[model samples]
Target: MYAALTSLHWVYLLFIILIIGVMVLRRDTTLVCIIGIFLLGLIATSSLTTALTGVFSSLIYAITQLLGTILVISIIVSLSHIMTHTGINEVMISPFTRLIKTPNHAFWIIGLLMMVVSFFFWPSPAIALLGVVLLPVALRVGLPALGAAIAMNLFGHGIALSGDYVIQGAPKLTADAAGIPVDQVIQASIPLVIVMGLVTTITAFIFMKRDMKRGILTVTSTDLQHFDEQMNQRKAPLSKGLRLFFAVLIPILLILDVVGMIIFHLQGGDATALIGGTIIFILMAISLTAYKNKGLEKITDYLINGFQFGFKVFGPVIPIAAFFYMGDAGFIDVFGKTLPAHSQGIVNDLGNALAHIAPVNTEVATATLTVVGVITGLDGSGFSGISLAGSIAHLFSATLGEGIATLTALGQLAGIWVGGGTLVPWALIPAAAICNVDAFELARRNLIPVIFGLIVTTIVAMFLV
Candidate 1:
């Protein structure tokens, strides 16, 4: 494995460590990521011009990868703006408000619903679908926006995505890599996933409640007020009948979207596109109903506002996403196969190297698998590195002669928990943007609970192994 690595690999590893350090210090990593991409291009191709060009290419690649998410979020926000302005949002959330009467009720209900939807539809679409409806309810009930974001991130991205039971995509990936039956891996993951999910969410909720009590974090009604102001600015508000009609029609349409996704087997980008397209139609209906002849122009205005907010939120994420993309397939795409012949991409190669460095034992193997999962997940894609986790689990299980299923599940859990979205600012953008909270701040708040969850989960894995 060491023999397979090159100067390019080591340089990439060094930058990964550096970037993690910067992030741990709560510093902006855009500049750092940009420099890392440049240097990696410089090292891989040894051409100054190529290095500079790679920076631009990488950003484009990241944007392309992220474009679907950005578009869905923009459309959702645009629809939300219209809903708020038409006084329809109030009606939409009124039912949920009754059930979610307190902050605690808001957190648990939103989180559990997010997790269930994410299990089938995946987190991106789940966030888009539920965020608009449930978020305002959560906020009105005194759950801060950040807390709402955290619930969606943890349960949707962290737990549902990690286990991936309904879709079985995650389990299949790890199971195949570990050379075991998918059922084995799935069965093995059950306890670990439950432990991880409970520990992390309960811990996060406790911390949030503590902060709220201390007044360090408090609910602000500004978002509701802003929407009220927007509604007042409208020359002619939608009739109460119209508002009630759309409020009823929208949820039914969204539920049908979910049914369409299930019947058509849409997931990920396909699932998100379904939701986005539905939102656009709904947005059109409301805009036309509310503004009459001016509706055509208002449609453009709403879209513009949505896109503006979308790009503004995504602007900072692009550079860092670009840099991380280079660690995987983006390297070959941006640099034209500059990696060494034997390299399994920079991230996978680094993971392999780490696997070789550690000695064999239940404890060592368990710890190493968790660490490798974290390292591979540094690219901010939990799925991108999970195959590596499976491969590494295979290597260790071969040495240990037992616990292959448990190890595979452990690695899968760690990778997805970190890169799936909970701790990755860019990856968690759906939750952050939907909840109208800062992505980085959401990541910061999630850091402790996720870390704690991983530590506890690793110990459990060690014993199970």
Candidate 2:
């Protein structure tokens, strides 16, 4: 039984390596991941029908797991789209342009603003809120669009989403999978999150400065120019009074939402639901006030557009996520009664095997968990592999004793940093699209800082653990 389980674990690892290989080659891994699910099911259950059904079942499971994130993103996007029509979106950020008189200023302001906003509203909505309004300012101030993209991607996706301190989505997932309290995961992640954020953001800023000194900090693309022109094409039909009212009112409302979270101690889904509820109300108010009698029609249009964007972004991720989800013990219900009764999950089994086969020490455990987190992130959905990370962290903790939270936090950080948006092209789309730069190029730019941050963070994690 042990040998068979270990062999199955090796198969899972083999598929993970293959997925990463394809991603490194700049190829899509959706098909490869689907095949992996089928093969794993076939080997585990010894039934072709089970394997085939598992493919569909896994996809459904992945979608179900991701639906909340998808809905929140869609609603936020819809809100952003509505605000754009009223020109309030532009009004909302125009004040920041004054501070961005230089490339360095633009980088810091954009990056910092994105981080804060993403922490509250998530990167997807935050990108939609800031991209059109800030990209032009950053460009005019001598920051290359690519640099601006890097700033947003690094700060928002890498920092805010990785730690997920405010909303606690990442920690919730990791903690739940690890069978630990969410607060424990969040507490353990704080220092590592700061370290990772500071190291990566500072490194990126340095790179941007160097690029600027070399006279390479220019956006020469006509596409960017076109995008800017299109953004500016919509005029603020509202009076200055109205625009100013909303500009101040909107921030206050969002800030209040943050305050509510803090006062009520809401975390994870509750916090997200709060933000989502606020955005919906904001969307309704904007549609009704701006579009008048046409408000209903306009709101529907925005929602449809938002859902379209949301699903489009999520489409390629589903199959890839499905494969990784199977490696988590939490999804056994999703896969029905097919899984072996004693199976702890492929990733958990791997961790157990590694613990027994090797000298289980802090460094080895830390490295293995980090690597597993990184591997799970290959699907380009950082949250998908976190449960696996949590499960494996639990297994390793049992062997090593103590520091489960620290190891789990480390795995969470690694998974999110790689797969969240910085290192993956598909995941970087919101930031890239907003900045009017190539997602692949943005990923390339973020690679060095993120990897270095991960290494430094892992070392720090060893000490903490």
- Winning candidate number (lDDT): 2
Off by over 4 Å in 2: 1-61, 166-169, 172-182, 218-231, 316-332, 335-350, 373-388, 424-433, 436-444
> Candidate 2 lDDT (Cα, whole model)?
0.79
* Candidate 2 residue-wise lDDT, 1-465, digit = tens: 442364567777788778767754556777888898888877777789988988888888877766766777788778766766677867778878899998889889999999987876678778877888888777776788889889998899888988887656678767766767788998899999999999999998898788878887676667467667978686766666776787788779878988998899876677778877887888777787777898889788888998997787667667766776777653465445444446666665666666677768999889987887787677687765666677678778866768899999999999989988989788888888877788998898899999899899999999998
**Per-residue lDDT of 98 in model 1:** 78
TM-score of 2: 0.82
Could you tell me which residue pairs clash in candidate 2?
none
Best by TM-score: 2
User: How high is the lDDT of residue 254 in model 1?
Assistant: 78
What would the per-residue lDDT of candidate 1 be over residues 1-465, giving only the tens digit for each residue? 433878887777677667656644545567878898999999888899999999999989878866876776677678867776777756655566579989999999889988976764567756766776677667777888888889989999999989986546567556645557777887899999999999999999999999999998777778766434543554428888888899899878878887987799775567767888888998898899899999999999999988886676567667766766676678889988557876666666665665577657899989988987786566576764565566567667756668889999999999889988988788777788877788999999999999999999999999999
Specify the poorest-scoring 10-residue window by lDDT in model 1.
227-236
For residue 68, what is the lDDT in candidate 1? 73
Q: Quantify all predictions' global Cα lDDT against the true fold.
A: 0.78, 0.79
